[model samples]
Target: MRFSVLSFLTSAAAVSAAVIPSSSSAPEKRGGSISVTPHDSYSSSIGVLGCKINTNRAAYWPSSPDCNNICVKVSANGRSVNLLKVDQSGGAHDISYDAWNYLSTGKNATEAPTAGGGLAATYEDVPMSECAHLLKDGKHLAFAAANSMNFITSCSANTWVGKNYALYNILNTQCTWGYDELCRMPDPSQGNQPICEHTLGLTVALKTCPVYNIAYPTGKLSIAV
Candidate 1:
């Protein structure tokens, strides 16, 4: 696998949070407001993590990745729905228009719902396996490598895989060759076939990718060819 020096630097430059291990504690049920957001090309397809999500389904953007690809059971307005965690909202739960409409009217609507404040709701994390039916075919829940800097970058997603083995091979090559270099994988959500050529700057290569152990949404999810 060929690795690009520039791509690694670009990914590293986008890094904001320090390289810390993902939390291992279980996610507890929480109450908050589920804001309604318009569905657009980006929201319907490319998420902040560069993953493709089915907006037509009960999809939502959580404030973080604690529920990434996990099934979240949300209750509001005397109605309940199971939402698939697909993107980052930076605020409280921001749900797709379809999800909000269903919660408000108890039925799916073709037109967008009337704009308003978030609906008061409570949500709890459920395993991804339970929500697998909601995801599109060829999509799967994948964990991020510990040093992947995924939280702050849009070039990669926990679940997005390169159409081919390009990105996977690049990471594997770097790991096998013991190259301590930062690298950017292709943004698959941007197009059907993309080249892995973006750049991220770094003088020294980061540590080897570690197998992250997380507790919630239990299962070993991996990025594959």
Candidate 2:
């Protein structure tokens, strides 16, 4: 086993080069209380999804260099938006570059994302003309009453917040029918529920919420808008 100096040098160089970016281009302190310009709400017509985020919205750094998972809030023109994150390959950011860019630099986000354009753009503030999920955020924000539920062995129809909401079975993503069954619980049960992306995405608790605030019924957690 004669040692090849060239091979050894090559391996060392490659490994050393890989460590450079990690030690050099560390991501900046992400997530803070920052204000954004007052742009129109994200609409299907304009090509954005989710709630019409204003200054009152809260965001999480899901992936931030700060060990605290600590997010500092900021505003622009008195509005706040969260910065989605990017850590590994094949992530939500790849599909939602517009959102990513907006989080990166709030100045441009104030402007409209490309209308019917593809996601991702050069920071020139121009339309990509390729993005198509503009209507996605709206669906995500639409708070419709839970007509279905998961993981619930049973459920019942009740008037919550003066509206009708369904309590259903727990449906974790173990099986298709199980998930479906969980979404449509017409009875009541005690257990974990299979909550889907759409369910979590839409916290329609306000439209049909619980009647009493057991947390601090006597003091705080009062049932009020």
Candidate 3:
């Protein structure tokens, strides 16, 4: 049997591209001991999501070149939040340019995203407005990032409702009921649950965003906040 040499080369290149880390700033550990505040006692109203990378194992590169699927620990401020391990089998699984752009560059509501390139911003520093852009994009990338960073699924719903959770605004809205089901904390009520933007702690898990800070030196499987 003859194997196609060109096909092997092409496959190798594709895999190389997927796994390689783009040139960018590596996360530096701040001078502080590792700390984790539990979700039950944690309290905050800022609505920020940060990704603490435990182990970047994903073939796809995140906005931060160093980021990978390796166990991302979601946190708000300095407290730890519980994340549901989701099976992204159904529906779409893609990260949009706009979402990727914001994640890589910390693009805010005011700034428009360019075509390509990565950013140095960690999940913690990424502004809420930039996150809003991702949430509003209504793509699987938004959902992926949300899940990675442990953003409240209901938060995405409220985002879909936009500024007040009043009218169902498609532009402001991101994911649908289907997306929410992907989360570990699905709406207990039958059918789709009502949009509750202002209400906090609607779901069993505490509200949180991504925390991209990783504990690099220890080589431990944890994203420190």
Candidate 4:
């Protein structure tokens, strides 16, 4: 896959405390000024995961305490397969695509809005037997008969949501959405295809930034701005 070299902003500053904002606060105006909560929740330094800063509620994806880290859930045949903890600073969408590529090709992949032949992104079928090799735990045999294709198909057909949540909200103080600016996200496909080819069975609605912090050891990641 083709990877876009996106430059991210960074500061040497470190946050002291992190807290989720209460839902009762009135919604900040969409596509307006972004407010930064002065706290130590975010760090310019990279962590176990690639999380950078604490995002506000309006922010698309939440930053993990660890920089570049992402949590993923893999499911097949309507049954939960495994929860994956990985690292990718490219954002949630890119990380998701990379996970798919690893499962399908057994090779590391990069971020790209398009795939082979510039077609909608797609992955190869990988049988569950091969999971042991491609996945971290090379010896689990629970879904051995199932294939990666089933997982991919299930992701695209069952879990995928359209474009990520809007990035022009208050929590996304750093990103400039409507105008072409440094942090603006790429436009999504009109066919409801995810920025990532498929979803990873994450419970949270896909967000524009796709960055996240893990909520639990299993299931979808619970991300907060």
Candidate 5:
């Protein structure tokens, strides 16, 4: 389930709004409140199809991919710790257990904080080049797949046509035919069925067959003399 950094750069067609800056000067700092939560499976080490991240070094999950692999400087309780943005929190500045403990008490505790609460924090996105020592490879941040199952299945098929066909099937079944842009309408002339269009500049042949039945012997047969 390992993905190279190159794969991510190519597949991620749309760039997020929080683009990492190219210059060496400090980036604009964003301030927000942080909530401490218990570490999950992806707490310490990198998870399946996830970026190479060292969560032990004050890692925090941001709300979007824009912050992926970006080094963040978290300041709170008159203390500041530089942490990496490794995973998604669905909300801004979701600090990991160990990280929060370190930030508040100045001790990286194995257990959760007794007095759990939110902390006022300011996050500054440090450029990847500047934070090379913190990164795994010093340059690359392996982008995690949004949908690992779909990624694996499509990669296994290994064809643009196959991927498109799979996408069509998913859209046809899950999405509204007429309302959704990708979903196709059921053609009344073709038995009111939805079919893959050949307009994709490639010809695809689809086939169907009836189910086969198997019979078992009821009794031994005697041969005629």
Candidate 6:
């Protein structure tokens, strides 16, 4: 069996709130002014989360507080909607499906028209045994198997959405659908093809572990998972 480059972020650490960077060149204040209940949240300082800002409804968790921190307010069918910032796990580069929906369906957003009706942007589970390595005590075993996550955080909504292996080398196809603007993320969401390879996110997890002093504790990982 072959592995990928992107391992897993095993080690744990004390992280502070970070923001993504926004555009330096302003959009040249246009003509008329607009109001928004659910507005598009834009900011100049964005970290860890990248340059994208959350819309009225795209954000989740502490990142969001009510109808604030939105990206853009879209105008659809005479009604308005707010675009929040939700995230995609592996693609780490693009926005989540839910966030995509919220942003496009708002009066606060750019009103990117719906499906030609007019044109709308559109946007999972697996087994437990298959995901055993990812568990510690019926939960994400970040500490048990991977031994980096410290095994405390909650698991993603569903499992088995996809699977990947870690290796020093990756195929181009692996990253065909993804796009990487930084050294961190290098693949596209749709990746290239059977020949195109990429470093999987799992690889990144393990790689970052050592930096955080989280070496894999032999017998700690499991394939039965």
Q: Best-fitting candidate, measured by TM-score?
A: 1
How well is each residue in 67-87 modelled by candidate 3, as lDDT tens digits?
A: 212123233233322221111
Off by over 4 Å in 3: 1-45, 49-213, 223-225
Error of 5 at 55 (Å): 1.5
Model 4 lDDT at residue 156: 23
Give Cα-based local distance difference scores for all models. 0.38, 0.22, 0.23, 0.23, 0.36, 0.22
- Per-model C-alpha RMSD: 14.5, 21.1, 18.7, 21.3, 19.8, 19.5
In candidate 5, which residue pairs get closer than 3 Å at backbone N, Cα or C atoms, i.e. clash? none
Rate residue 189 of model 1 by lDDT: 77
lDDT of 6 by residue, 1-225 (tens): 011212122111211122222222222121122211211121111111111112113322222111112233334334433332322122121222223333446421223322111123221112334333322122221111121111111112221111211112211111211222122212567443122134322232122112111011111112110
TM-score per prediction, in order, is: 0.45, 0.20, 0.18, 0.21, 0.42, 0.19
lDDT of 5 by residue, 1-225 (tens): 111121222222222222222222223445455544433223211212222334344343544323222566777777876665544444545554455666777765443333355666666665455445655455443322221222223222322212222122211110111111122434567542234333311212212211111111111111110
Against the correct fold, how does model 3 do in TM-score?
Answer: 0.18
Per-residue lDDT of candidate 1, residues 151-210 (tens digit):
424323332222111122122212321233223344677643323223322233334442
Best by lDDT: 1
Better candidate by TM-score, 4 or 6: 4
* Candidate 2 local lDDT, 52-158, one digit each (tens): 22211222212211211112333333333333111111111121223333444453332433222222222211111111122122222211112222101111222
Q: Model 4: residues >4 Å from true position, as ranges?
A: 1-46, 49-71, 76-92, 96-98, 104-225
Model 4 deviation from native, Cα RMSD in Å: 21.3
Q: Is candidate 1 or candidate 4 better by lDDT?
A: 1
* Decreasing TM-score order of the candidates: 1, 5, 4, 2, 6, 3
Error of 4 at 129 (Å): 21
lDDT, residue 33, candidate 2: 32
